[model samples]
Target: MILKDIRNIYHSELDALFGKEEVDSFFNVLIEHYLNLKRIHLVLDPQYMITKEEEQPLFEALTHLKSQKPIQYILGETEFYGLPFKVNEHTLIPRPETEELVDWIINCHTERSQIVSKEPQTKILDIGTGTGCIAISLAKHLLNTKVSALDVSEEALVIAQQNAELNVVNVEFIHDDILNSRQTELVSVFHKYDVIVSNPPYVRNLEKAEIQPNVLDNEPHLALFVDDENPLQFYKAICEFAQINLKANGMLYFEINEYLGAEMIALLEGYGFKNIELKKDLYGKDRMVKGVK
Candidate 1:
């Protein structure tokens, strides 16, 4: 079938299942994923056609989309901070907000370098580095920074390791449950990092009903949530780790639950961290919180 015919059918199929707007969005994403064709390309070509063999994957992908699977998962890869990274059900898809957090770190590193008073080699650790997006991006952008990434899930770490190699960045990846107090392996493997960053599981269980099916059904729940009563559990653990492992005046950055900005700032302050700052995202919601240990 011609590309136009396929898109029309795909849109109609999806629109009946999802909605007209969501179907349109899915169609655009599918075209890009399957044909390496963007919306503009569809407008430009107008008569582009998909071969029979290509049609199989396209139709299969459309089936999953109708089931509400995320396009990134359907494609098996995504761009994070301008770097391509492989993704799957084991890892959460990297978001644009996290990219902003990465940019902030890179800019901070550059500013420190300009003053000629920065550490010779800044060390960084990305806790809960699901796909190693944060760790790998930092290693790629900050040339002299040594990076280590840790995840509890061996499955997630495998994907994270692959992403590191794919991005041509050097990252020391470790597999360990961050929640286990006995897992001193990571605690001792690398002690003093200049910066520790995380985009850990901040979603609460009670909020599950609010999550889109594309995420709640397909993405790793281990990488997505904590008990509703202790929504800040990961943040608290990570802060405590930073206290013991981070160098004096070292920075701690987190992509926090938007609803808990003030509470997170308070938590960091209680940890004796200084220069606590809360920053909002493009949506004007409190999204990032940082503190200097």
Candidate 2:
């Protein structure tokens, strides 16, 4: 089949499930992923033919898309902060907003290095490190940095470890349940970190209706949700852990739920975290919060 015919098929099959623009985007991504051809290439060669073998997987993907499977999961990988990561149902696909969170941390550390005469080797830890996107990105960008990541799910950690190797960064992966453990239980493994970050399960059960079908049906709920009664559960636990594990003047960063910014600030203050700051993502929703120990 020719490029134009395939494009039409994609739109006709997926337009109702996803919008027109998104369907177009998905077709473009599949074309690029399967054929190594860009959208402009398709436009330039509208008569470009795809073999039966090549068309089979694209059709399968269309069926998956019709069932509301996320394109990232369909592809089994994604790019985050300019680095590639392997993702599966075991891990939450990294989002653009989380990339902004990584950028904020990298920029902050870069500025701090400029102010100091010599940049000290920094130890960084990422909690609930699904896919190891934040930890690996920080390690990839920052110089003289030692990065470690922790997650309760061993399945998620396996994918995270693969991502770290794929990105050629050395990130220590630990299997620990942060919610069930005490500070003393972690002290032996986690001595001190100059920067601690987590993009934990901030989406509450009540927010299920707000989530897209692709995420609600396919993604790991353990990494995506919190109890509605106590929405700040992970944030509170991590903050308390940071109190004992973070070095003096260490930084804590979180990608948060937009609705609970005020509650996040209050929780941080209550935990004795200083210099708290809230930042919005590209869409202007309050998505990131930072505090200092």
Candidate 3:
């Protein structure tokens, strides 16, 4: 069958749900993933043909897309910070705003890579490291850094470990709930670190309406939400942990809820973290915050 007809079917079915531009992007990604053909190949060969067997995956993906499943999960892989990662239902898909947070960390530490310091090794930890995107991206870009990531879900950790291996970056994966303070072994893992970063569950239940169906329906809720009554529960725990675990002048970063930026600032200040910075993403939303210990 001519692939063009399949492309038309995609437009007719998905245009109302995802719009023309997004449908085009999805079709392009699907064709590349299933048919091993690029959009350029399609443009150059409008008559390109695929056997029935070659077309099955594309149709299956279309069915999933109709249900608002994320394309990245359907593909089982995504690119973050110019590196590839494996993603699934157990792991939240890495976001562009999180990429901004990773970029901030890399830029802040890029000088450390140049310094020939015989002092203690630079260590960094990522809490709630779904897909291990932040930890692995840092390990790939920053030199001479020991990176560790922790998550409550063993299934998410499995995917995170696979992503670490996929990206060829070394990351220590910990399977423990950050919110559980009673675990003795969990405390032992919090050695002094040069940096502690997190993009924890910051979304309040009230904000669910703001979330698109694609995410609210498909992504892991454990990684995406917190009780509206205690929206800052993860942040509070990480803050207290950083106060004890960070080295002198160590840095702490978080991707935060935009609506709670002022509250975040107050929370960090109350925890005695200094040099707090609330930065906006490309969308100009207060998306990330940083503090110094």
Candidate 4:
């Protein structure tokens, strides 16, 4: 069958669900991934043909996409901070807002110092790391620094570990829960960090209606939501952990819910974190917060 026919079928089936442009994007990406054929290839050879076996994965992915599954999960991978990461139901797909958070950290760290440490190198920790995107990206950018990531789910940790290896960045992956008192104690004893960052479960149950079906139905809720009445539960826990584990003059960061900027500032203040800064993302939503211990 002509590959153009497949492309047309994609638009016929998915254009309404994802829009024409996104369907084209998906079809192009799928053909490239499964067939090693770029969009230009289709333009150059409109009658491109493939074996029936070559059609299997594309059709399977189309079936999942029709059900509103995220393309990242359907592809079993995504790009975060310009690095490749494997993702699954166990891990949350890294978002553009989170990439902004990473850029802020990278810029801040890069600008803060140029003199490599004569003593202990800077240590950074990412709590609730799903795919190790934050920690690994930091390690990849920051030189002579030690990076570590912690997550409760072992399944997520497995993917994260693979990503650490895939990125060729050494990230100490810890299997522990930040919200659990015993595990937090053990984790704190392992190392005090110069920087601690987290993009924890901040979305509240009330916000579920705002989420798309692709995310609500397919993504990991354990990495996404909090109770509406106590939406800051994870933030509060991580803050408490940082209080005990963050070194003096150390920095802390969070990718936050857009609506809770004021509350986040107050939370950081109450935890005695100084010089707190709330930052907006590309769309100008208050989506990141940073503070000094």
Candidate 5:
């Protein structure tokens, strides 16, 4: 079938599941993912055809979309900070909001270099570094930063290591549960860091009803949720780690739950962190918090 015909069918079929607007955009993006064609080509060459061979995967992708599976998972990879990273059920698909958190870290590094007169080589640690998106992106962009990442899941760390190699950036990936404070060990070579960043699991189980089924059912729950009994459990544990692990005047950054922004700020303040800042995402939702140790 011609590319145009396939897209038309895809749109109609997906529109029945997702809405017209979503299916239209989703089909175009997925086509680009599989074929490497630009959006303009997709529009101009609707009759552009795909073989029956290609149609099988396309059909499977459409079925997954109908089931509300995220397109990133369907593609088996995603672009973050302008770099390709592999992803699947093992990790959360890196979101644009987390990109903002990364940008803040880069800017902080730049500003510090200006003040210090020497180009500072920073020691940086990423906790819960699923798929290594945050750590790899930082290492790719932040020249002279010694980067390391930690995650509890060995399977997730495997994907994260592959992404680090794929991006051609050097990062030490350590497998350790951050929740287990006694067992969470830093790499001896890169011990204390000027910045510690985490986009840890902040979603409360009670909020699962509000999340899309694909995420709740397919994405790794160990990476997506916190105990409902104490929603800020990870935050508290990370803050405690930061207190002892961060250098004097070091910074800690977090991608937080929007509803828990004030609570997070209070939590950090309780830990004696100063210069606490709460920032919002593109959607104006509270999404990030930064504090000085």
Candidate 6:
């Protein structure tokens, strides 16, 4: 079928499900993934024909899209921090706000390096590392940093390991539950890190209504949510761990639920973390928080 026809069908079927703008984005991404054609190629060659073999997968993808499956899951991969990451139902698809967290970390380290007049070989840890996006991105961008990532799910650790390798970054992947009492023992094997970061399960169960069906139905809830009664459970655990595991003057970073910025600041302060900063994402939501021990 011709590209224009495929585009029309995509819009007709998906516009209702995802809206016209998102459908256009889906079409562009799908065409690029399947045909290795850029968006310009579609516009320049409106009559570009897709082979029967290619059409089969495109049709399958459209069906999945119509069912409210995320396009990243349909594609089985996504780009984050300019690196390719393999994702599955076992892993949470990395989001753009998380990329802002990565950028913030990088910029902070870059500024520190300039002040020190040398790039210190900093050790960094990412707790609840799902898909290893944060760990790998920091490893890739901060060349002087050694990175380690931890996840409770073995399946998530497997995907995270694959993404680390895919990005050609050396991120240590650990498969231990952070909330377990055994965490201290597991963490002791490694030296204290200069930085510890987590984008852990912060979505309260009460916030489910705000989540889209594609995420609620298809994404892994293990990485997305906490009990409504204890929304900051993961944050508490990580901060406690950081007290012993992070070096003196070490930094802690978290991508948090926008509603809990005040609570997060209070929690960090209660933990004796200093120089706390709450940063807004591109959308101006209080999405990231940092503190120094």
What stretches of model 1 exceed 4 Å from their correct place?
16-25, 36-47
Taking the tens digit of each residue's C-alpha lDDT, what string does model 1 give over 85-184? 9999999999999998999889987898888764588889899999999999999999678899898889889999999889888999887766775783
Query: Please, what are the lDDT tens digits per residue for candidate 5 over residues 20-75?
Result: 88877887787777777777995676677778887777788988887888988998
Better of 4 and 6 by lDDT: 4
TM-score, structure 6 vs. true: 0.95
Kindly list the per-residue Cα lDDT of model 6 for residues 43-128, writing each as its tens digit: 78888898899898889999999899999999999999889999999999999999999999999998898888765689999999
lDDT of 6 at 293: 100
The global C-alpha lDDT for each of the candidates, from Candidate 1 onward, is 0.87, 0.91, 0.90, 0.92, 0.88, 0.91
User: How does model 5 fare in lDDT?
Assistant: 0.88
What TM-score would every model get versus the actual structure?
A: 0.93, 0.95, 0.96, 0.98, 0.93, 0.95
Worst 10 residues of 1 by lDDT: 181-190
Residues 13-47 of candidate 4: C-alpha lDDT, one tens digit per residue: 99999899999999989988888888999889999
- Clash count in backbone of candidate 2: 0
Model 6 stretches with alpha carbons more than 4 Å out: 118-120
RMSD of every candidate to native, in Å, equals 2.0, 1.5, 1.5, 1.1, 1.8, 1.5
Output the number of the lDDT-best candidate. 4
TM-score of 5: 0.93
Alpha-carbon RMSD, candidate 4: 1.1
The deviation in Å at residue 244 for candidate 2 is 0.9
Query: Largest TM-score belongs to which candidate?
Result: 4
Query: What are the clashing pairs of model 1?
Result: none
Q: Candidate 3, overall lDDT?
A: 0.90
Candidate 2 per-residue lDDT, tens place, 47-140, comes to 9998999998899998899999999999999999999999999999999999999999999999999899677789998999999999999999
Distance from true position, residue 201, model 2, in Å?
0.4
Lowest lDDT block of 10, candidate 5: 181-190
